[model samples]
Target: MTRYHPFLVFLHWLLALMIIGGLIMGGNVLAETPNDDPFKLVALRMHMAMGILILALMVIRLVVRLVTTKPPHADIGNARVNKLGTAAHWLFYVVVIAMCASGLAIANMAGLPAIVFGGSGAPLPSDFSAFPPRMAHGALATVLTLLILGHVGAGLWHQFVTKDGLFGRMWFGKRS
Candidate 1:
């Protein structure tokens, strides 16, 4: 079986790290920082930056995927599994795009607080629920987290239970 291209592998791992980091930062900014905390805006800004980077990288990754030759899917003796894997991959892209869009909408609706960038503080909305984008962003994030867990579990299952060497397809370097 053919292995994934090196650039594709790089993009995969890079985006994975960025996405996970963004998620962690977002959680900290949203849950850990009190609304009254001076640093809350700073955290929000950082998360926003991370989200933008993810969006840019994801766009580039999609373009690369479109132009490059992808390895063939494994014939794991089950057409249903192959279809599920394909659908899951697409789901990841969809969720990421949705998350970024909603996040941007939230920032826009909130007027992109200048305080997030070290400027004088601007008052945030006292009620986040008043912003429809905030609600969508939160809901999408929850779905993304669940999808990530399912993706990881599927990878592990392929690596161990299936033993089809499918995991090696995404690993770095040449297959032995």
Candidate 2:
């Protein structure tokens, strides 16, 4: 098949938009809002919900990818670069899952479920920096951002430079 299964394509684009939105909301909106702000709770609830959804969808995507037939890997005439592409594709799964895990750890550690979701009157912690997973979550966010940029750059290269139609492989089209 030259193209991905329709469901996979759907998940690809859906997850792409969601991951980007989650990153922006977490990094900008949530970051700028002080923990004491009442709106901070609202933002946290949204961000947390999005993160969880992303995680669940990723699991479904992984399963679909494993059981479905896909187009052969693209070749750019460089073995090293080709291997790098393969590794990066797999890394997306790893990094995203890790990011979700760290986010969940932070939530549990900080009692976010009670404060943000349970409507508990307890105040949010003065700072989340005290949670060890907070550090990992921040680091994973940076890594996820970089990986996304690289993935986009590689896709553009395939489409505009190599002219190999690699971009279409992950897009919607007839399987063969």
Q: Report backbone clashes per prediction.
A: 0, 0
Q: What are the Cα lDDT values of the candidates? A: 0.80, 0.94
Candidate 2 Cα misplacement greater than 4 A, ranges = none
Using TM-score, give the best candidate's number: 2
Candidate number achieving the greatest lDDT relative to the actual structure: 2
User: For residues 20-122, what per-residue lDDT tens digits would candidate 2 score against the true structure?
Assistant: 9999999999988999898998899999999999999999999999999988888888999989999999999999999999999999999889888898989
Show the colliding residue pairs in model 2. Answer: none
Instruction: Give a tens-digit lDDT track for model 1, residues 1-176.
Output: 36777787888999988887887777755657765776667778778888888999898888887787767876677899889878889898999999999988877777775546547567766545677988888888788888889988988887899887777788777743
At residue 125, candidate 2 shows an lDDT of 95
